[model samples]
Target chain A: MRPDFGLLLINLGINNTVYVKTDPREIALLEGLAKDDRQAIETIYKQHYNMVQTLIINNNGSADDARDVFQEAMIVLYEKARSGTFELNCLLKTYIYSVCRRLWLKRLQQQQKFVSDIENVSETVPVEDELEAHGQRNTEFQMMEKAMQHIGEPCRSLLEAFYIQKRNMLDIAGHFGYTNADNAKNQKYKCLMRLKKLFFAAYKNNTP
Target chain B: MEEMQLLDAVERYLNNEMPADEKAFFEQLRKTNPEVDQLVVEHSMFLQQMDRFSDWKQYKATLHDVHSELLETGSIQEKAPRATVVQLWKKYQRVVAVAASIAGITALTISAIAYYFAPKPASEIQLLSRELANIKRTQTITDKKINALTGQASTRFIPPADPKSGGTGFLIDGKGYLVTSAHIVANADSVYIQNTKGDYFKVSTLYVNKQTDIAVLKIVDNRYQPIKNLPYALQKNLADLGEDVFTMGFPRTSTEIVYNKGYLSAKTGYNGDTTTYQLAISANPGNSGGPIFNHSGEVIGILSGKQTTAEGVVFSSRTRNIFTALHEIRKDSTNEDRIKLLLPSSIKGLDRIQQIKKIEDCMFMVIRY
Candidate 1:
C-alpha cells in the first residue's frame, strides 16, 4: 500500500504541468509500466539504451562496459520507480545520466585497484556540474587557440619558434629570413604584442 | 629610442641570447620597466598554461568522440526488439497488481479496525504535533547555520543537513531550526542534522508545507548550541531584476554544499495565482526552503520551487510570502486565526473566509518522521 500510494502520487504529481514535463511518450511508457504494461517498458529500453551507451562511452568508458552500466542503471531506476521511491527532480535524461555516471565511476574505481596506469578519468563528469565546468574549459581553450591562430603567419612562426621549438635568436632569424638577430628580436617583440592583442580581444569576446 | 632600445634588450634577454654587457643593460631595463617585465613573465606563464590546457582539451574531445562512436556501434550490435522488456514487464504485471490490491485492502481494513477499537491518544497527538513543529524549526535553523559557517552563498550540490542520506538544510535559529525541501526528508524514517563543524544530532520533529513543498525539522538533542545573536528574519524583499542572488542547497547530494549565483529574472504569484509571490532563482530540489541572499548577504527570500521547463528557467517563492506564512503559523493555532492573520483585514469577512477555506484545502501538512 505504501509503495502503491507513493507511486501513484508521484505519477499523478509528475503528470501535473507544473512539474517540468518529460517527453509525453516516455511518460506514457513509464505510466504503462507502472500499470504493468509490458510494451511500454520495451519501447523505453529500445529508444534510450543507445543514448545511455553514448554517455558512458563519451566519459572514458568502453562500449561493452557502457552497455552493462547503462542496463544496470536503468534497472536500478526501474526498481526505484516501481517501489515508488524515485523522486523526479530533474529531467529523465539528467537522472539517467547521473545514475549512469555513478555506476561508471564505481566501475572505474574498482578497476583502478588493478590497473595503475589508468589516466585520471574524471568520475564526476556525467553530472551537470562537471558538464558546465567542461563546457567553460572548452570555451576558454578554444578562444585561446583561435587567438593564437589569428596572430598572423609571421607572429605565429615567431611564437612557435621561440616558445615551442625553443630555437635561438640566430636560428629564428635565419628561419624567418630576417637581416640579423637584433631585427629578428624586434620582430619577435612586435609579434608578441600582436599576439597579446589578439588574445585579449578574443578573451573579451568570449567572456562577456 | 629608449623604448626601442629597452624592447630590444628585453627580447634578447627573454631569448637568452644577449651578450654579457647587453645582459647587464637588460638587468637595468628590468628595474626601470618592472611593470613590463612582470607582464612579460605573466604572459609567458599564461602561454605555458594554455599549452597544457589545449593538449588536455584536445585529448578529452578526441576521447569523447571515440567513446561516442564505439557506443553507437555497440548499441547497434546489442539492439534488441523494443517489445522485449515491455513484454517481460507485462507478463509479471498481473501478479504484482493483484498483490498490491490485496495489500491495500488489508491496510484499509487495519485502519478501520484501529479507528473502531482503539481510541486516539490525545496527549500523544499533541506532543507529536509540537514535536513536529520543533523539528521543523530546528531544520530551518540548522540549514542557515551551515550556510553561514561555510560562507558558501550559492546552493548546488550541498550535503544534506542529515549526512547519512545526503540531504541539505539550513539553520534558521540557534535553537536548531533547520529548513530544507520536503522532498529531501520525504522518505526519511529518522533524520539527523550535521553542521560544517561535523557535529550531528538526532532530529525528531518535522513540519512540512506540501503546497509550497518546504519542510522544517528540529534536532532534539543538544550536541551543539545555536550561535548566539544571529539574525533569523526572512531574507530581504524579493530580488530586483538582474540583482544577483545566491542559493545554498545540496544539488547532487554531495558532501560539500553547492552555491549557485543567479539573478532574479521575473516575479509572479505562486502558479501565477497572485495570492502568493514567486521569484525566479536557480534552484534544485534540495534547495527547497533554504535562504536566498542578496549580495549584502542578507536573506532576500527562501528558495521554495524550481521548474526545469525550458533550459535555465527556475522559480522560487518570494521571501515576503514565506515570512507571512511563518509569522501567521507561529502566532496562531486555529486555522481561522491563522487565515485571518495571513490575509488583509479587509479580506477577513464571510466571502473571504470561503476563499481562505479553498486555499487551506490546497495546503496539505507535510509530516516527516
Candidate 2:
C-alpha cells in the first residue's frame, strides 16, 4: 500500500489556510515528484502531457516541439516541487498549463515563429518568479556539469563517488583501488577543491 | 593539508556529526574569526550546490528514460508531418505537373537551381552501418526456393531466421555486458551477439539512449563463460587531437574482424556535435558500434557514423557517454546487477598486434532480429 500523506496534508492545512481547498492527491503526487519517483512522473506524464502536447500542436508546433516544451515545463514543475516551498493555490492542471504556455511563448519568440497570442480556455496564474528561479537553477546545474566534465579522470570519479553516489570513503577506497579510506578522503579533498574552482569560475563568467 | 583539515571539520560540523562540545568550540571559533565564519557559509553554499546539481542530473536522466519508455509503449504518440505534406501536395498536384513540364524544357537550368537551393545539412552525414539483414532475407528467399525444388532441407549450422539489423559491439564488462549503437537494435524483436569464434549468445537490452546512440546489453545465454577482466580501459578524458587511433570491426560480409588505423582529426563530430569525436578513418556499413582505441589501448569512443559528403571522415560517440548511461542504469531499483567498469589500462605499452589480439576476444557482432 502507498504511504498515507494524511498527516502531511493536515500539517500543510494548519500551516497555511491558502492550501485548505487544495486536493490532497495533488500534494501527494507533487511530493512523489519531489522524490523523483518513477510512478509519480509517469502518472503526471500520462495525465498532463497530452493536454500540453495538444496546446503546442495547435499553436504552430510539431510533435517534436510539443515533446520538448512539455518536458522543459515538467522540469520547471520539478524545480518548484523540489524547493519544498510551493503552495498549490490552484488545480495542478491549470498551473501546468500556465507554465507550458509561458515557456512555449518564449520559445516561439526565440524561433521567430510568433504569429499571434496562443488561445487557451484554461485559467492561468502568475509564474514569472518561478520561471526566473528555474532559469537560475538551470544555469547553475549546467555550470556544475561543465566543471564535472573538465575535471578529468580519477578526480572526477572520486568526487562523484563520494558526493553524487553517496558512497562512504572506505567503500570508495576499495572501488577506486586506493590503499585506505584516509587516502581516498585526501584524494576527494583535492578533487573537491578543483571542482569548486572550476564551478565558481564558470559561475562567475555566466553571471557577469 | 591544513585546508583539508579545516574543510573536513566544517563538513563534520555542517553534517552535525561533530560532538556537542566540539560543535560549541567551533561555533565559538566562528564567532571570534570572521574568516572562519565566511568559510563555513561558503562551504555550506557550495555543498548545497553540489547536492542540487546531482539531483538535477538524476531527475533529467529519469525524465529521459520515462519519455523513451512511454514512446515505446505508445502511451504518447508522435504526429508525423508527412501526412499534412502529402495532402498539400495532392491539392497542388496540377500546378506541380505544369511546373514540372516547364522545368523539363529547361532541365539544365532547373538542375542548377535545385542544387543551389537544396537542403545541404540534412544530407551531409550518413549512418554507416547495418544492411546484413537485407542480405540474410534475400538468402533465405533463395534457400526456400531450393528447398521447394529439392524436397530436402538445407543443412546449415545456424538456423534460418530474420536478423533485423547488424553492427559491431564490444563487451564493456567481462560478465557478458555489451555496448552497441542504439539504432542498430532499436526495434529488434530478439537480439543476439556472436563472438568471432562463431559462438552466438542470446542477450537482452538493459538500457538505451537514442540521443547518445548508445545501448547496453546483457548476455543471458547459459553457454557463455565470463572473462576475468577486460584488457582496455574506457577513457574518461577526451582523446587528444591528432592522436593515433585504431578500430576493429566487422565491416565485411564475412565474419572476419577488420582493422583500420586513423588519427583523431577533430574534438567534435559532424556539425560540431560535442558528444562525439571526428576521425580521419575509413569506415563502412558494418563498422557502427566499433570501439576506437588510442595508442595506449584505452577505448576513447564508439564509432557511430561518417560524413557522407566527405571522404574518410568518421565520427564516434565519446566513451564518457557509456559511463553516464551505466550510471543511470544503476540507479533503477529493479536492476539488481551492479555493472562495475574496469579502470586500469592493462594493454598499455603493448604492440599494435598484441593489443588487437586481446581486444578481438571482447568484440562481438551484434545480431538483431
TM-score for each candidate, following the candidate numbering: 0.28, 0.47
Docking class for model 2 is acceptable
Reference-based lDDT, residue A82, model 2? 85
Lowest summed lDDT across 10 adjacent residues in model 1 chain B is found at B338-347
lDDT of 2 by residue, B192-222 (tens): 8888998778899999989889999999987
State each candidate's clash count: 52, 0
Q: How big is the positional error of residue B349 in model 2, measured in Å on the Cα after superposition?
A: 99
Q: Which residue runs of candidate 1 sit more than 4 Å off their true CA positions?
A: A1-208, B1-166, B231-233, B236-238, B269-285, B332-369
Local accuracy of candidate 1 as per-residue lDDT tens digits, B268-312: 644574323445556665555566655554555556565556555
User: RMSD, each candidate, Å?
Assistant: 40.6, 39.9
Q: After superposition, how far is residue A191 of candidate 2 from its true place, in Å?
A: 1.3
